[model samples]
Target: MTMSLVFRNEKFSPDRFTGCIAERYQFINCDFSGCDLTDTQFIHCQFYDRESEQGCNFTRATLKDASFKHCDLSMNNFRSVNALGIEISECRAQGIDFRGASFMNMITTKSWFCSAFITKTNLSYANLSKVVLEKCELWDNRWVGTNVVGAIFSGSDLSGGEFSSFDWHSADFTHCDLTRSITSDLDLRSTDLEGVKLDSDQVSILVERLGIRVEE
Candidate 1:
């Protein structure tokens, strides 16, 4: 806490910030709904809106196990958010839309399971097109130009990620670890590394971008 709660243009109603613990807050144009915000934390918060591009809404929010440290949450909307087990560390969360965020937990109706931790976040240009986040932890994120056409992130760890103009053929990352990630373009001949885990200098920089010369 330690002062700094602003919450301008507020519209909260529904468990109003349940289990709260905020710090350094601002949250302009706030309109959070259905807020349960279980185990909420939220340190160094801002929730963006630098004169309009819109931010801070959290529509249909539950935020099951919220954390959100060092937050800015740029351009935030978070439609239909349930955010099961959410964490979000060192956040900037640029361009965050997270369409209909759920972080699954069905257990029936075709049994489902997903959870989020989202470490060291920047999440540049975030949209997360078809989010699933299979076995989630999501370490050291930056993900510049991130849209993730049909995101799955199967057995995810995403170790030390940056991923410069990331496309990786619109995302599924089976059994992913992506050790010390900084994949400049990740074109492993059309990308689809079965049980992905690269390291060894990122497989010699993705086999020298397919020119191949690993004579070591």
Candidate 2:
């Protein structure tokens, strides 16, 4: 039993929508500024151009199977969400906290996630292209089979992450921390590794990949 609701051009500021449950809702051009949506559940919802005028607070919200297209979600708190099968495209998600969130089967394209905290998040089988994750915390995250073409990860922490099936040929890893991160199967010939922080073992692996024999 799923109820359909629509909130078009509505504003929710300084309010509390905690513990609310809604299914198949549509939010078009709605503003959610300074609102506390903690523990609120929205299943199969679609948000189009949803604005966060003063930074909508979605801390601990459950947005399972939701889709956001061309929405402004900057400076929002999206930590601890059950975001499985989510689709976000052409959205502004800068400075959001997505740490420890579950994002399986997600697809995000042409979105901005700069300075966001996404450490320890599971993004397996996700496709993210032309996205900006610069200066974001991405340590200990699982990115197996993730498509990250044309993505920017400059000055981000990618330590202890598994990137076995990642397509990072056009992605930027400049000044990033790859300490203990797995790149055994990656072709670093065209990938940007300028000023990247790596341990001796990681450096050795990269040198070996380039067919450079080192004498010690």
- lDDT to native, each model: 0.86, 0.60
Residue pairs in collision within model 2 = none
Per-residue lDDT value at 193 in model 2 = 81
The lDDT, on a scale of 0 to 1, for candidate 1 is 0.86
lDDT of each residue in 112-143, candidate 1, tens digit only = 99988999899999898898988899989999
TM-score versus the correct structure, for each prediction: 0.36, 0.51
Candidate 2 accuracy as lDDT? 0.60
- Note each model's CA RMSD in angstroms: 12.4, 12.0
User: How would you encode candidate 2's per-residue C-alpha lDDT over 93-182 as one tens digit per residue?
Assistant: 444445544443324764433434455545565545555667666787667766566667788889988787667676888999989888
